[model samples]
Target: MPPETGLRIPQDNRFVLSNARVPTELVADPPPGATRDAEGALLLDLLVQNGRIAALFPAGMAPETACRVDLEGRHLWPAFIDMHTHLDCGHAIPRVRPDGTIHGGFSLTAEDWPRWTDEDLDLRMEFGIRCAHAHGVSALRSHVDSETLAYSQRHWRALDRLRAKWAGKVDLQGVTICAMEAWIGPEARALADLAADMGGILGGVTDTLDRGENGTYDALGQALDRLFALAGERELDVDLHVDQTEDLSAFTIPEIAKARLRSGFKGRVVLGHCVNLSLMPPEVIDRTLALAREADLAFVSMPTPMMYLMDRKPGRTPRWRGVTTANEIRAAGLPLAIGGDNCRDAWFAYGDHDMLDTLKQAIRVFQADEPLTGSLAMASRVPADLIGRPDLGRIGADLPANLVIFQARSLNVILARDQADRIVLKNGRQVTDPLPQHHELEAALGLLDTAS
Candidate 1:
């Protein structure tokens, strides 16, 4: 098979990844439940057997029973896990105008949603997943817009089919996304129950709230209470879009933290965006962080989309950068991750579902371009934990042999290069082909064109 079909692999389950650079320590410690060798560190040839890392041997030594393929000193990183995305919406050139603002993006998305067909959605989603897989993401959590309870149920069913089809190759989890108000009442409770029944997580957006207004606080608190109640009732985890705007009135992180504390909800909560944190008053920021710590919340920052949708006022050069206060979050020891959100959709016009692309953008936006700063944790280790897969992101004995082999000598060189010469391994096999069904989407979108 051609390399594009997937990287060529030798026969047999046992193989030696020759001359690979095994890390002495993860940039961050492995999340709770990760498996490691007795020494827990090494630099040697990785021995993979029956789709799990078997052992590490010194370079140039090949076991008689195993196949050997040389990495030739290329850098190796664990496969990526995207903690948040909207791939159920999939990739489309939005019909409505993109005015380069958040509202404009939302308007475009709304206009585009009703036009989606089952076939079209499946094709586009397959394309997006293949793109992410090619870039070395093996697990992902994709948010499906729950416009209504019925639509959300149908979306989860579709995701279930996709999940079965891509089993072992990629793990896809669905998140039912809606406004906080949608989580209220009997009908909403049924919806949340259906989502859990269909193996989907609970999700809601709390991006609208007034800081000091009594009525606003009451309304917001009621909505959050209902949301958390549904989550607790369904015994489902929650991923929220909170404070995605920089407007001071839109700050909802503090309220969410307080809600967690009040409800005493012990389920895992993942928050996305929190862009207002970058612009909040110092005292408010401190309070919010302290509350988040108490609530044990994790944050997923979508810098690429945030940078695109935020701070856009026509004819004005924006003074504020459109990203979260990442430095402060990291300094406070929060489990902060960066994700590839809204790829080629109305919310963002670009992206191929590449975690490295997102991580690179995060480095620039958050000024995390320092050695041993755990920047890669945004896509790899931290997200693995957020998605509750402590077993996936670490490279060690007894770990599943999912790995990304970059054909670069160093991290800096990989960052500087185009990174086309890379291969993804899933359970010791190379992924060579995109889905055959993706052809229709490609043709319709003019992506098959060889000439510009």
Candidate 2:
């Protein structure tokens, strides 16, 4: 199809095309009989101008612009959305004892990070982002350490710098996955204020210090209210790192439900790692589902880290589910999503940096049928919208050009061969990025190659 007369996709954006064997059902095309020419495989040539989507071509049409690139033998899909991750505090260089066995995030020390310069921080951040792109992750809500004295204020500042540096390249959710020790006392309020002012997040936690004065349901509830109020006052989003446990009686997440009901905060919120939701008996899961639905809460199941760490703990044979209840959550008409909690950090050990792997894992672990239903949506527009990502998921005219190209014929193949590399497209042009730089840690920890 020729460029329409008097129609232009602005001179600033780049034009991109992907031609491969994408599953028809997964990759929706304009109606087969839609009146248009220039039809090709999954035609919807993205025109990304000014770092945003400018236009889309239909029915095998080519862009009139000369600055166009074609990706051959690759499938295009919505980029993955990783809704949960710790950005600055975890990833570090491989260390070893005098005997010389390498260690990763588990051995990472706050001292090591301060030894890094601004350039070093940028490299680390860039490496993480590149890893995400290689595995088809477009947007991420990365949690940074803002309240920790070791990092002090540096991690949040690093995140801000990285956000500006990689703004147009990929959508970055600069959030504060705050420290557990900093949640109470006078420092907590100030830290919360800083996170809100810095365009970061006020990440709440429930299972950090045990059921103490500061860790009880009542204590956690008050802290959440105060922090949420601060976040509201600053007009910031709240992404809580709640219960990563199986002992239902040991915790009380209903307070989260109560907070939502009392404050009615439905905007820009994410409930990360509700692993305990699975153990909540049918009645509790049902009630929580009702509350999450009422609050318009988005549940993100970071299957990788959540499952890996929980499995390693004793008396904690994971039941219900390692992630949250997907079937019940979705059926409740709530905005449910998924994220790769950790890539190569000690918090997690087996993430491939690919949500495709997450999807495949979700099927067997959660009893989900393969070739996921509303699957891509879990890691695409759903999370993208939550973090204010501008149209990076859907393939439509005027959406962002952050896209992925795969070599597989269908979602089934993609799921079966999770790590198979395929062509990639970013901002309407082909690009290359890799997954987490600290994967050697997982290997050393022996977390990979498990049944998960």
Candidate 3:
């Protein structure tokens, strides 16, 4: 489907790919051999109008619009859609422990609960948004803990404020990260109710049972019942943070998968992590893959955190090696995508909200020969398809004006770097550049302690 008429798209209808060879068509294995072609594989001119793709012609294309820019010697792809990024939203990252149970630089219990005030949330969110945009992320799914969701009548107002703040430039999705609080029964429902009111997907913690011992084995069933019922009543989308640990004992995933089956959820449901399967016995991996395919369940792997979070014991290879092999997962026939779960929140002092880094890590880890195309799909097509926005992921006539232009000549060489200097345009105008303002987010949070 084409974007709605009358939106801003770059009028730069002419450009060239010097020595670049676009993926033109690769077999897309959403479920094993289910492959498809993406025509016009290489050199082209990408035209934009009203923030959607207006025209794409070979090398030089004539334009009815007088504005056109040459993106010679650069690469252009669809704007990235990060399916997961915690940002500084939750008190979750920055953990002093592997389980993310601690607060900032020091002790137990973390930051003050009241620290999540409007200014705090807004400030953190803005910093995150700026970082994401700079990283070429045009759409994002970020979450604040359930504490914020329970108090959403007061807390989540930040999302509305944020929507107003960056309105036309970004597409945002907020979830009530309820794993820590799901077994609370009524309180959890209230969070779901709040999410329903706000109009977006409700993300659940379905893997808590086997995780930190704080969550019940049956807690998932209870939470899913409450959440699914409420979402059913309200028609909300479901995105579960599934199988978060290396413990093969975690049974919540199957429960949630069964729930999705019972609920008749097709594309509206998403599964975030199944890290255990990354190292699961081949038979187990095979069965799980089949289940996911049958469930129409989508996967979002946090490359940095998953690689760092699990067991590293010699005998623990099955679960701790890393949760996602982008290439393997794709070959498994599962719809997959990548997300930067950590924005240097403390627990994970690594990620930069840059998908490029995530892609590089995936290539190294997965040994993906076609890393660029793999990373681009993980950040674009897969996420877009998962979210019901296909028009925005491709570059062609009638697609959304959401596209990315990278300041690089080759994919392999570009991703080999630690960061990328790129431009993200929503409707035709550049809205973000991640590299130039890398420290902006950290500085904003008083993370550097500049603010009191």
| TM-score, every prediction | 0.90, 0.78, 0.80
**Candidate 1, residue 376: how far the Cα is off, in Å:** 1.3
> How many clashing residue pairs appear in each of the predictions shown?
4, 14, 25
Best by TM-score: 1
Off-target runs (Cα >4 Å) in candidate 3 are 1-22, 25-41, 63-67, 88-112, 180-184, 210-219, 312-320, 325-328, 370-375, 432-452
Preferred candidate (TM-score higher): 1 or 2: 1
Q: Which 10 successive residues of model 3 have the least lDDT summed? A: 26-35
lDDT of 2 by residue, 1-452 (tens): 21122222223445445233332323433434323212223544555675555655553464676365454434567667877766553344333111111123334543355544565556566667766767667777787765463454677677778778776666677676654545666677677766766677777565654565655566666666776677777778888877776656555457776776687554566777777777767988898788766666777787766666664434546443467787788778877777776654445534455667776676667666643566557777677677776465666555656666665544556667754555555665455344443554335434345313
Q: lDDT of each structure?
A: 0.76, 0.60, 0.60
Q: Could you tell me which 10 consecutive residues in candidate 1 have the lowest summed lDDT?
A: 27-36
Model 3: lDDT of residue 125: 67
Per residue, candidate 3 scores C-alpha lDDT tens digits across 286-315 of 777777677777778877776765554544
| Regions of candidate 1 where Cα sits further than 4 Å from its true position | 1-8, 23-42, 57-65, 94-97, 209-216, 434-452
TM accuracy, model 3? 0.80
